[model samples]
Target chain A: MAFKTSVQKYTGSINKLEFGSGENSKALGGENVLPFYTFDGNIGGKPLIGLEILDVYPEKWLDELQQIYGDAANNAVQWARFVEEKFSPDFICLRLEGADPNGLNKSPEEAAALAKEVAQAIKVPLVVAGTQNHDKDTKLFEKVAEVLEGCNVILLSAVEDNYKKIGAAGVLAYRHKVAAESSVDINLAKQLNILLNQLGVKNEDIVMNVGCAAVGYGFEYVASTMDRIRLAALGQNDKSLQMPIITPVSFDTWSVKESVASVEDAPEWGSQVERGIAMEVSTAASVIAAGANAVILRHPGSAETVRKLADALINN
Target chain B: MERFMIIGERIHCISPVIRKAFAERDAAPILQRAKEQIDAGAAYLDLNIGPAERDGEEVMMWAVQLLQNEFNNIPLCLDTANKKAIEAGIKVYNRDRGKPIINSADAGPRIDMLDLAAANDAMVIALCAKEGIPRDTEERLTYCTEMLERGMALGIDPNDILFDPLFLVVKGMQEKAPEVMETIRLISEMGLKTNAGLSNVSNGAPKHVRPIIDSVFAAMAIQCGLTAAIVNPCDQRLMETIKTCDMIKGNILYADSYLEL
Candidate 1:
């Protein structure tokens, strides 16, 4: 039973990142092993839960979610503050859904103003997201990144198609960071990391979004994929892909009708609030197992569930 | 025993004159393969002087020193059936990196090598195959457990004793692939790392199919929680497959934008 004990040395060359200044920034980084593996190393910190604050209410959101934050849905500043006071999230993720190509199509400058306004309102770290459109995301992120200088926020979703522009802006304009996203497939996950590094973004400046899926869907696939990423970084020491991962748990959970729909949809499904909490917790736990460094969530109740679980998983 | 490791295998030992080369201290061919293997990503050079086992100690000592001298204190795996040779090589081995590994030990009478390795403070590779290769996961795991107990009795740390599941060549027993992968998974689940002679999976296969089979097997083994392997890192396709596999598995983080599928 005496297993050989040795320090798990990462095989790849890694570039480190500094998040917040002084004690707060040092708070991030340094997970040498996969999440929740107490036998290996210290899993000191919980995955930071950043609440999503859209400049405008997502019109398509389920009614149940709308009821919770309906008052601040129309105002970005109020929404940011509401998320902070109501949920006490570790960070504020501001998604500029209004700048979609077919939506309001707000210019980057306008989006930047809203982003700055949100950042000033919240004491927590900020995550700036743009419309899913590749071209628009690149352009819109640039302005927001610039106006939010010294905020030490996290930029969102720099996909392969438009990474150069987005990466350049995040590094040069914002003192913030970026997240590299890929489809469920693992190869795409790696290729995207190489592309981001080539763009001159250091490893610490980038977070990986392995593309989260809700529980009982493609979530396991995401979990296994993320687990593989952490193993390669911790065990094999492959530096090109060594970065903390971001899992947008709320978006994945909220999108699933089982989370918010009534019992009438499926009497066996049980309470909507309970189901939402269960789904979010399961999704976050799965990703954490795969070594997610941060997770963005919705439902105030679900966020609290994940935070408590993270404490046990990471700290214990 | 100290748990320093030497990941060794026979795939890259490209010399029919390997024993003679080491015996004569003919640095040319030995140096060539050593440099190639290490540069191709070998962490330790496995010096297996089979067939010519009489001067095991002499040849092993010379080759180990020759490899370390030229390769900047590189560690070695003194691979052979000859016990005296293992002792000879270790006597001269510089203790900076690690004690020379006694290529392997196992259950059955082969288990004696476990005590030999322990007495010498050297690490050893423990194959789950004692008399012969186990045909199923249960048998393989049983052999692993027995060997682990035997090693622990000799005061050898399990980490120092790498469990080799004996990578079976798919061309001969394709059905056993899953069984072998399952064994790897079980070992990893125990939080113990395993190493396989990765090149063994492709043995007897067609030339072009070698790298493909090896890389795919390496990927699958990795998925099963394998920590390392004995393979040529210079194989571009295989290396690329490993690199890409690492990313997909999330073992390594995605670079700036490259990991985007």
Candidate 2:
């Protein structure tokens, strides 16, 4: 009698969350196996890279980042077109940072115009990120969702405090997706997903942002929690966690001290450009290995490197 | 209730398909039913070869071997009145996954099953009754102690001794309904695991009302400290309610995907 090796039994398959209407539309989270464990089960989708674009120009962006897109860095549409023409990312994530209370404090309508201009300039799907300001994000996302109706945009977040507002704007009014967020807590992540589902948003249309940290700062916690979420969904058939797992690496990585430290400040750490790219790519790799279906990364070079790595891992 | 002890009750010999399958030794229907229950998150299967008297020994051994071969040492509860049949099943039972459970021992003359369980290193569900169901929590505890002490004296491990305050039909015992919950609470308060043949609570009721009543009672029973249940795993509503109750009580970790799990 031939006894095969003991294999993990998975009862649930990830819900493939697709965006955009036709060609070049991308999807993730349809795998039956743990990330890249193809010997056990099928990987329904490969991890895709979404390059980050900003609606607000931060006054102190790193020299390396500014050097790559000099004048394009000042305008949302020009910056988006530059990234598309250069990196050709799978998608574009436009962070509405100007809406933040501490930032330029742009109006919701102003941010919506910037989103529309960027989305129109790019062929790929747009991921409209909020300012992490609940009230402002609700109004800002609603305007963006309304303006970018048929573009199949993904609202960057709908949190526990205001899932009904943002979730409604994306799913109820516009034919789009919502990124449901929770603080590094997986229970809260599942709770947010439940709240969104209760609002009539289909499970496949929601992406879970269970919180992401930089490579040096509690990276293992983010990865392990994401893996646990996937196991609960695919292994234990958790319907609330079955949606695609997404992480925002750009904002967290760029702000970390290690990524910003200059070579003269720490020459042993390597070139500042390479160090920043390493920070972004390393975090992306960790989240992908931990079962991220989609991730938003900042640098063009980091996105290129991570996309190549994703292809290799999926094919393995 | 950090994790529920769900005893799949679908293998009862009373079911027409099971009866026919057991008679013909057809593994198809038996395997199908077992797989369905396992997929539905049943922890153990209660193989109730109902009233298998004459050939009980042979049929019991056959099922124990058949199920073990197919499911790779899946824990089983040898549920039958025939002590000899339970012994026969335990003889070939695989202990890799878990030890077998003797369907029951009672405070009545059937108390000898406790000896069978002790010798076989198996768990046994002890019913709190000598002849008929106990009238109240005090009377129930009296019989429960009798069985508990008997098993303890026989060298049976305390954790291996499970208690069942027999659930009576709610349709007829409407006045006695709260007694079962009280008995379960008292048993649980003593740090002993409590179980019940839960479907009995809906017996004689209309088919459509059975599931609703069983689920509602299950939620109430969990609140009263019931640890395990002999349930129809295929009963979607009943199972969903059991999982939901576990979440609300903060016993089992709550996940939105709980229903799927």
TM-score of each: 0.59, 0.64
Top candidate by DockQ: 1
User: After superposition, which runs of candidate 2 have C-alpha atoms over 4 Å from their true positions?
Assistant: A1-5, B1-196, B199-241, B244-252, B255-261
Model 1: how far is A48 from its true place, Å? 1.6
Q: Using TM-score, give the best candidate's number.
A: 2
Query: Which CAPRI tier for candidate 1?
Result: incorrect
DockQ of 1: 0.19
Weakest lDDT window of 10 consecutive positions for candidate 1 chain B? B1-10
Ten-residue stretch with the least lDDT total in model 2 chain A: A56-65
Q: Model 2 compared with the native: what TM-score?
A: 0.64
DockQ of each: 0.19, 0.17
lDDT for each candidate structure: 0.75, 0.86
Cα lDDT tens digits for candidate 2, B73-185: 88999999998999999999999877899888899978999999999899999998887777687898999899888899999887788899888899988877899889889
lDDT of 2 by residue, A1-316 (tens): 9978777758778999888667867887788879888778788787878988788674667877888888898998999999988998888899998888787889888889889989889888888899998988888888889888898988988898888988888788897999998878888888788778878888888988889999879888897789888887876666788888878888799888888888888988988878788889999989999988888988888888888888887675
Docking class of 2: incorrect
The deviation in Å at residue B250 for candidate 1 is 14
List the lowest-lDDT window of 10 residues for candidate 1 chain A: A20-29
